[model samples]
Target: MIRSSRLLNILLVSVLLPLAGLSQAAGWPRQVVTDNGTITLKSAPKRIVSTSVTLTGSLLAIDAPVIASGAGVPNSRFTDSQGFFSQWGAVAKQKHVQRLYIGEANAEMVAAQAPDLIVVSATGHDSALRLVNQLSSIAPVIVVNYDDKSWQQVVTLLGQATGHEDQAQTIIYQFDQRVTALKPALKLPPQPVSAFVWNGGGKEVNLWTADSAQGKLLQQLGFTLAPTPTQLATSHSMGQRKDIIQLSGEKMSEGLSGKSWLMFVADEDTVNQVNSDRFLQQTPAVKQGHVYPLGNDNFRLDYYSATHTLAILEKRFVH
Candidate 1:
């Protein structure tokens, strides 16, 4: 399919531009009860530092005043080592947000920003406990566990932590409305679509399940995840058993089967890369020509990315 990015870019600007006022909804002396424990803010933080890149999308979506934002761990998705995902680059640049340390959250580098509040996830590439303990010396730290929560919950937590819960709700509501509006034009194949991301430069493929960025959005739109071949699921899950699964291209065709496929990539070039793989080329998606590359800033998705995902589906299937 051809790229139609201008449609969604215009949609995002029109919907999110007026949210600046929502960030000003201050709830002073806010006490957030997180998985680690209760951390209380002295006041609504004017300057915020987010140590988790996943949380950065939520923080920015709510219009919180973040001075610095950290990047995600390497290979976590489309995120990079710079502690910034290109998906949110526009907002980060507009706010003049300092790109903080990526990799594991570094206490010393985060302290340099001199932020009033620091936010992170309990489980991720970076240890939230470590950040809470180390960064607490500099400012208040709020840690949230996202293992069992939906993306909306994560955004709501950030909203409460930064006194922007209303803005968070507003954003989530807008997304819901858009999903409903797009429903009329959307269609799905008989079987679930296996949505995954392929890295063209590195030749790696990762399955996006219910717990992942793509899975969450597509499942919400009444689509099911592709059935993981019994053997692949066992091999991929191992002992821990997480929602998202990763596999090499050779094994990918064995695990994925359906009439349609939604592939996520950094650009169109990755599509060509996937096509060149003999094993990947054998899948039913390839045979039927149902493969579609997810457009726009979707390689790594978060709160803001969900809106773009909807836009992509609406344009692709909605006549």
Candidate 2:
């Protein structure tokens, strides 16, 4: 009887040992170092908070659920108004997105949500970093440098941090396939000198060079960049503020005589004002209907923006 009991115990141990190993394999380590900083994760974080709209969008794209999102549009209803997050369902159905709009994030509010991890974009605001530092006191904070990282890199890093690398890679592969399929369909005009205009309080226009993502997109579509006074002057950053000769209506018409124009406006009033301006009306692009208005509000150089920008370009310019 004793020998029989020992045999049964041995069998139970043999069966349970492999199950323990499997459980350990499934549960990844709690801490990971990202490009921005070292994140100390506590267990597999089920609840996550994202500060940037791009990060939020990227997470959703990878099938990762975010408990809270900071910036984008006010409500899910208005998200589609810009056509960026239009198909992301409702705010209520978006897992645990607390209806919180913080142009600048509040650390106290983040703490209140009690997220297992916090993700933020490194951009125009330094407040996000401060919030991350503060939140780190309560939980792990992972800062993603959105400006420098490519879309694939961002998605991969986020997947690694969230333990969803395979899932993220699958989504990225699908998106790449779609982009590849759509590239051949675009017919770009040869030597088409395109000018990108960004309208704000002041009627500002920016000339995209080879380095700019928008410029690269245009290049892929076979459009050439228009040479402006700044382009003629000393070479500077793609989107840098430079001292360029702002031509009046008469001069602008003559200056942009031969080239096609691609204009981007924030609001309808600004678009109307630019259209009504005599100088802008004289430009070749305006006369020839080459003006391309970027209607999406989520226009940035980040991963999400790049993909959406490509889709918009394909739809409007390609077709």
Candidate 3:
């Protein structure tokens, strides 16, 4: 009786294993609806190439099989010599991610990588939309619009495309846990803060709106973004971007009317610059000594940079 029972259990295990594999297989050759259109992948991508430098960090965070990527301006405040963002450049180097190009998207270099998937941003300076026709011939191409989406949303989208949904879910859960724990420990600077990237000695400024990832993250941590004045709502001097409102010249003081100011992609030097600028010395934030530098890598929020941002904030506000 014991021998017969053992045989039955072994047969049952053999039958169930293949069914489990089949269940997971059924979802493949998946159809992902993107900004460009519908793209179908016959299998999970093994060699992925990201043309958008901003999107590369999220792809790496999820452990996607990114073999190569395009890069941005190199050796700047936020990037390395290869033009990879400071937050994820090390990871890219570790993974042996080849540089497809620096400032422009190159189809030939991308083709040499022999990627099974290619990701392009729908908007931004890093967009490869113009090269879509050429890249599509090399592999299945998907266009993602990161400007209007949060980093988590960007991860979720890339997760689906790269067949790493489990990794995507895990990272977001971890980030949410950190946010929850940090929320209670904070002593916020002030209510209704103004967040922006200030440059050119107060000549160029881009204000973050509630629609941006940085704005969303600040709001998640109990900070409020001051509303853009109605008269300034239509200002699009920097192009039609949903993430920021560009202001310059006489409009600088009118738009920067927050109780406190948080500068993104900045450090202590930037804060000093804001303080010393004669034109900006009278600004409410500068006058009250409420201006703070979030960090140099705070411009593009991804899992790596976002994590760094949380650390910076906790140290700044969590006395």
Compare the candidates by TM-score and give the number of the best one: 3
Candidate order, TM-score descending? 3, 1, 2
Model 1 weakest lDDT span, ten residues long: 235-244
List, residue by residue over 171-196, the lDDT tens digit for candidate 1: 77777777777776686655578887
How do the residues 256-288 of candidate 2 rate in per-residue lDDT, one tens digit apiece? 433555553233555566567755766566666
For model 3, how many clashes? Answer: 0
Clash count list over all predictions: 1, 1, 0
- Model 3 TM: 0.90
TM-score of every model versus the real structure: 0.80, 0.67, 0.90
**Candidate numbers, best lDDT first, in rank order:** 3, 1, 2
Q: Which is the leading candidate under lDDT?
A: 3
Off by over 4 Å in 3: 1-26
Residue 21 Cα positional deviation in candidate 3, in Å, after optimal superposition? 18
For model 2, the local distance difference test gives: 0.57
Provide the overall lDDT of each model, using Cα atoms, as 2-decimal numbers.
Answer: 0.71, 0.57, 0.87
RMSD of 3: 7.4
